[model samples]
Each structure stands twice: as structure tokens, then as C-alpha cells.
Target: MHVTWGRNIGTTVQSEEDLYFSANSENWFDMSSLGAFDTYTSDNDWVSVEKMVPPVETDDMITTRDVSKLCEDISSLYLNEKFSDVILVLDGEKLHAHKAILARCEYLEALINDGSQHLQQSEIAITDVSPEAFKKLLKFIYTVSTITITSNVGLIVEVLELARQYCFKDLENATIQTLKSALNLKNICSTLNIANLYDLSDLKQACHTFVDQNALEIVTGDGFTDLSQKSVIQLLERDTLLVPEIEIFKSVSKCKLNDDDDNLVIGSVRLSWLTVEDIVSTVWPSKLVEDEKLLGAIVEIVEVKAKTSVCRAKKCMKNNHNWRKIDL
Candidate 1:
């Protein structure tokens, strides 16, 4: 998810996967992220949860500016002691809040209505979510605006997890965009894996492209050498790898030599492209036995392959042979 917002106007995005949006004139953005406001109608009235955000479009779509002024007005009342209806004890610090806004958090709303004596007291305490994280959440809830992400790059993943956990779809997308922007050489591999896990398709492709472009570096990088089996398997399956297959073979060999578990991932590699010696040394050493017979057949095919004086050792001049002659 990538969000590019213009000043009080449009938002451009280059999404990698699914973005579910409800279509209607009244509903334009999901308010659940910010106290579950439902939709932003011209009257600022509430609607059913079903009437949520429509697809992110630049033309005729509303920006956060719609209710942004309203949020600022509401925020003014947040810190006023006389106007505050609820108190939040977060990580030992007390903060003023409101029932209407807090109700957006379905879990908190349920707890408040569960007849707990504490709810009757208009006070709630939380120890799990950090104050810093909660503060950012509250800021977004009250501002209906972007939470500064550049300075908080290190915490992007954490914020994303928090948003997803709390069903804050818009916030989750914002955090993902931050994560994508913060991707770097050191974290690219793990980021790629995480993106794949969370289906952040745009970030995943960016990571994949990084791997392809920096194949040699990544293959030799500390964390990448220990890359997970799934990532390794996926990398081996690509035809656009920047390095030669031989180099990949060496890299994978080094990886398996370090951990036998990597041997399983190596099974998926197309061994037919490897040289006869590589098949014997690397593929044969591993327990990918299924390739043995095929390798033997390939060897036989290469051996019986007609090679004249001019074409003997020069691979550039090698001609195709009827591979069907090789026994399975």
C-alpha cells in the first residue's frame, strides 16, 4: 500500500494487492480507524458500518480535509477537563478521552458496556499497548491526517501491526506505505518476507527487484545467507535473477552447507541448467535425488551431443540436439 496525498486535493497510490472499499455517494472512507465514524457525508452524520470508504480515486474523491477541521474542533475538547467524559490511564500516564470516540474501538466499547465497575467510574487503564504507539493512534483519530512517518521509520512495522490488530484499515495502509519508503539494504530481505506474509504486493515486488538487481550482494549478505526456505525457494524459481545460475548454485551451496534445512529449498531449483560437475558436486551432494536420473540423462545427452572441431568447447556455437533421445 502506497499513499501519495496532495494538499487538500487528491491522493495517488500504487497498490500491490487488494483494497476493499464500499461504493456509495455518502460513504467515502472508513471511520473505524478513527473512532469508527462510518462515513463522511456532507452533513457529517453517522451511517452504518456497511457504508464505508469507496475505492481510492483521485477524481471526485474526498481527502482527509473533509472532516479534518471537525477533528481539530473535537480535539480541542479532548484535553479540556470539564468536557472530558473518559480518562485513559496509559502506561502510568493519565489522558482525557471521550466515550463517543473511544467507542470506535469495538473491544473498548464492549468492555465499557460489560458492567465492569471500572467502566462506571469513567476510567480505563491499559498496560499492553505502549503510550507512544497509542499516542500516535490517538493523534490520527483526532487529526484525521497523516501521522509523521519519516522520523518514525524504525517503528513503522510496529505501528502497522498495531493498526491491523485493531482493525484500522486506513492506518494499516499508511503504515505499510511508511514501511515501503523505509526499506533499505539491511532490511530488504526480511522486509520482502514480511511483505509476502502480509500480502504487501508492491513492497514485495520492490524487494524482489532488489534481490534480482543485487543478487550477488544479497546472496552473500549475512542475513540473506540465512534467508528462510520459502524466500530461498522463491528466489531460485525466478528467471530474472541478476547473477548467473552458477553463482546462485554456489550461494545456495554455501547456505545448505551452513544449515541442512536449506537442502529442502534447493530441491525446487531446475538442475538441468547446471553443468554436469555442478550437478555432481552440489545437487548430488544434497538429497534432491529426483534430479539424479534427469541429470544422468542430461549428461548422456551432452556426451552424445555431436561436437565438431570448430564447435567442441565453444558454448556460443553449440547447436541444439534432439533431447528425446536421452532416456528418462
Candidate 2:
């Protein structure tokens, strides 16, 4: 006799069999993965266990097979041009698609319905995006419910740009999330650049946080020299930047920017935070700053340090005054 249980729970073939107490009873085990039932052993009582059975389907439920078949049917129509009404000319290749499916994209809908040149022409030449990225866009249009995004960084970035250009909000969001998860020391700079270019505020903020947290490593890395002057300024101005002021100064000096931007980028560094010796030894020798500006910054650091020392001395004197001769 077969006894039914909840989905992913083991089934029973006999009545009143000793139920083994597996601490992992809630987890489903694939019996097929093991050669036989004798392969599984529990120190506790052995139950008449069988492999977990597929859940019984109800009218309200949708099965995985049904969803798979639906996606497959929809995907089969992708690039099938037999009844296609529009041809998207991307780069040097032509992609055939139906207007109804293309209409799902807000940008394409506006172009197809409103653009004078696009309204009647069956072929539209797209120059801004490559065919590979656009193919992902079409796949999403066809099977959004089941489409898998590529993990390749370059392709994902292309999709991000295409998604934003086409106003594919879901695809854009998914791409941003993927980028966030994919962030690392090597790609953080380029990823930040992409975020800034696309005005992806969420991803931009994540990159900023990552940069600030890994400031020393990021500033010392090779990518530091590739940052734009404006990006470097923005990074240096951040209050949470965890790198030493000397490193910030050194990295900003290495950025490939014009002389005019050098003044701006250098201004973002807290010159007063650098020690007098550091200014004379490192900053002064580097010649990143003019003699006049270097002198002023050095003087300012000296004054601040002197004042700090005075305050500490006074505090120490006051504490000494509070200590009275005590007799044991």
C-alpha cells in the first residue's frame, strides 16, 4: 500500500513501519542518487522509506513542466521570421521580429507607433547597440519569465546599456543586481564608470561604498591611474574614505588628467591632514602642487599640530592640579 505525504517528504510503502528519527527529516533525499535503500543507514529505527514523490497538482497550481512548456513555446518564436513584420538592422546584420512582441518595449513602441520614418518601414537600422546584446533583449521580450542572463561581465554590461536605452526596466534592474554581486577589486573602477555613465544611482552608490571600504587597495591598484579627474575628485571628497591622506595625494598625482584638472583633483585632498614632514618629503618632492600652495599647506598643518599639542598640555596640567598630596 502506498501512503502519501507532503511534497519533498519521503513516502511510506508499508503501514505502521518504524519511523527513523533523522535530524534532517525535513530535507528531501534523492534515493536514486544512492544505489539502494540499504545504502542509507540511521542509528535510530529504520523506517519503510521510499523516494519523495512529486506533489499532487491542484487546479490553482502551475506545475514546472507546464511553465517550461509555455516558455519553450514562446521562445520557439524568437528570431523565427516566418511571419515577422519588422526587421531590426543591428550593426551589419538584420534581425526579424514581430511588431506585437517589439511593442512590449516602451522605446520600440514609441518608435514604431510615432516615429515618422519607422512607422511604415519594415526595416529599422539600429546603430547604437551590438547584435549580441540586442539578441538578449529579444530573448527577454520572448521569454522574460524564464530567460537566463549571461554571467559574462562584458555581455552583462552590454545588456545593461541596451536595457537602459530601450527602457527595459526589469531587465535593467536585473542587470544592475548582477553587476552589484559581480563587483570586485579588479572591476570596481570600470563598473563605477558604467554606473556613472548610465546614471544608475543604486549601482553607483554600491561602487562608492566598495571603493571607500577598500580605499587603500583601490587607490594603490593599477585602475587608480585610469580614473577620470572628476571621479577621483569625488572619491577623495568622500568623508568615509578610509585611505591615508598621503596615499590619496599620491594616487591623485598619478591620474592621467590635464594640468587644469590637477588643481581641482589636488584641492579635494585634505592637505592639512598631511604632516609637515610628509609635505616636505613626499608632497613637495612629487611637485604635484605649486611651491606657494605646498608652503601654505605645510604652514597650516604645523599650526594645527601645534594647537593640538597645546590643548593636550593644558589638559595634562589641569589633571595634575586635580591630584592632591594624599596620605596613606
Candidate 3:
């Protein structure tokens, strides 16, 4: 005979002949007369135990795979998505993988945030600059994105730093172009400071050239007094590449003289070698015309004054006396 139990729960038992029979109504079990059937220790218990082991182990393995896969997919997505957005046109193209790009962005952001924190902690409001402009900074970092400077002076400076950080050749060249174009007498001092800080030799040369070209104008302007002592000395020490034209010297002479009062004395004027001819022509135009002895004395005095750096020329000496005889 066969004995069945818990048909609704899919548990059953079979026996050819039962010496004794006992089974749970809710669960089924087969037993010999020698031992009692225990419903709690049957196939259902084994099934539950087996189920628990696999899920725990399976979950762990799945978690490991998902983490690794996530990392790879995210990296690939960034490379594929962000690379196409680089718009700067240059001779060489820079391509970056997603992982590296993200890392660079994070680093730059940290730098900016750290700088901001320093400014805030120091209570230096004026030094508080926005990192907003650095949005494109990261693209230049990992991918060495091509940079085109149309007009923004500040952006040019920023890009130069970015190039230096990433060792981007083409981006650095673009920055140099912008620096060259933006230089002028008014800003040359600031440009020089920036170049020195960043160790930009080419930028330093460009600034020097600008200052040299506009030496006279810069020295005479109100802005000259505002320059730092170091900047003034640097300007003075730079080699004069070319002399100023006669017309420029004439202008300088007119600037030194008092328009309303011819008798007024002007003090020492320092002129560069480039502008010496212009100065001589303006002060002694008559010397070029007359080889006469009287005119020679006046020319000699002018030459002496120019040489001594005591550029004051007297309109009229005591009793209308020509001091030319004094060997001045």
C-alpha cells in the first residue's frame, strides 16, 4: 500500500507494506517502523537550506561583476561622448579616454576649490576669482584640446596655464600667439609679472619687445609713475633694438618745453640711444644749417647737456650772454 500526505503541498509517501505509519498533516515523510518520521527534517527543509546558500553566494558574485562592468562602461561612455565635442582646430588632434578625462576634471575642480578656500580663509576678497572660466580647462588637460583665442585676454592667460599643466604643445602655441597679440605698453608690466611667475620665456620676450617699442611713450605717460621700481629698472636695462625716428624725438622735445614760458627750465631728461638723433635734430636744427662759429657753441652746449643727462637748455642766460664761450 502507498500512503500519501499533504497532497495540497505536493508532499507524498509510498510504502509497500506499513509496519507503522505516522506523518504530519501539513508535511509528508516516509519512515520505517524502527524510527519515527520527523516532518521538520524532510526534503522541504533541505530545499530551504539549499535555496539560502545559493542566493547569498550568487549575490556576491553578481555584485562584483556589476561593479567592474560599471567602471568600464562609464569610462568608455565618457571617451565616446566627450571626445566629439572638442572643437578647437589645430594641426594635431588630441583624443582622451573617458577615465582619464574624468580624473583630470576632478583634479582641476579640486585645485579651483582649494584656491578658493585659501582666498576665503585669508579673508582676501579681491583675490576671489571664479573658476567658471575654467570650464573648458579640463578639456585642454586630458585631451589637450585645441584652443583658439579670438579676443578674451583673461581666457588666453588661463589657457596658457592649462597648456603648461598638460604639456600641450599646440595649445601652448596658441596661448603664445594670444599673449603676443595682447601685449601693449600699458599692460607690459603686468604681462611681465605673469610671465615670470609662469616661467614663460617666449611671453617674457614678447613683453620686452612691446616695452622697447613704446619706451618713450610709456616713460612719459602718467602710468609710468605707477609702475613698480623693478619694472622701471627692467625697462631701462633692456637693449634698445632700434632708435626712434626724428619725428619722435621732435615730439619728445616739444613735450619737455613749456609752451607759455620759453624761459622756464626743465630738468634732467633721459633718452634712449634710439631717440638720440631725434633729440639732437629738434634742439639744434640751426646747427645743421650754419657752420658758423657762434652756432657751433650752442650746438656744443646742447650736445654736452644731452651727454650729461642734464637736459635743461637755457632760453636766455644773464645779460643775454651766449654761454657757448664757457665751454659748457
Candidate 2, residues 1-328: lDDT per residue as tens digits? Answer: 2223334246544322333323234554434343334534544433445545334437987778989998788678788877899888888788888888788899888877766688889998887676887888888888784234344678889888899888889888878888888888888888888887777889989999788667779988999888876567778766666566777788888888888998899888777777777787888888888888888877887766632211000112264563212111
Lowest summed lDDT across 10 adjacent residues in model 3 is found at: 46-55
Candidate 1 residue lDDT tens string, 201-268: 87778788777656667866776666666678777776555454545656676663334565565665
The list of candidate 1 runs beyond 4 A from truth reads 1-68, 75-82, 150-154, 199-203, 253-261, 276-328
Best by lDDT: 2
lDDT of each: 0.60, 0.72, 0.44
Report the candidate with higher TM-score, 2 versus 3: 2
lDDT of 1 at 169: 73
Better of 2 and 3 by lDDT: 2
Colliding pairs, model 2: none
Instruction: Estimate, for each residue in 1-328, the C-alpha lDDT of model 3 and write its tens digit.
Output: 1233323333333322322234422233434432333343543332111001111234345566787776565544432545443322122333333333434555433433465453133121112222423435544554444555444666767766765665556667766777777776666666676776776788878877676656567656545554443444455443452223333233334442333321221111123222234445554462322234324544654665544322212223567763411112
Quick one: RMSD of model 1?
16.7
What TM-score do all the candidates reach, one by one? 0.59, 0.65, 0.36
After best superposition, candidate 1 residue 122: deviation in angstroms? 2.6
Q: What is the lDDT of residue 131 in candidate 1?
A: 72
TM-score of 3: 0.36
Please tell me which model should have the higher TM-score, number 1 or number 3.
Answer: 1
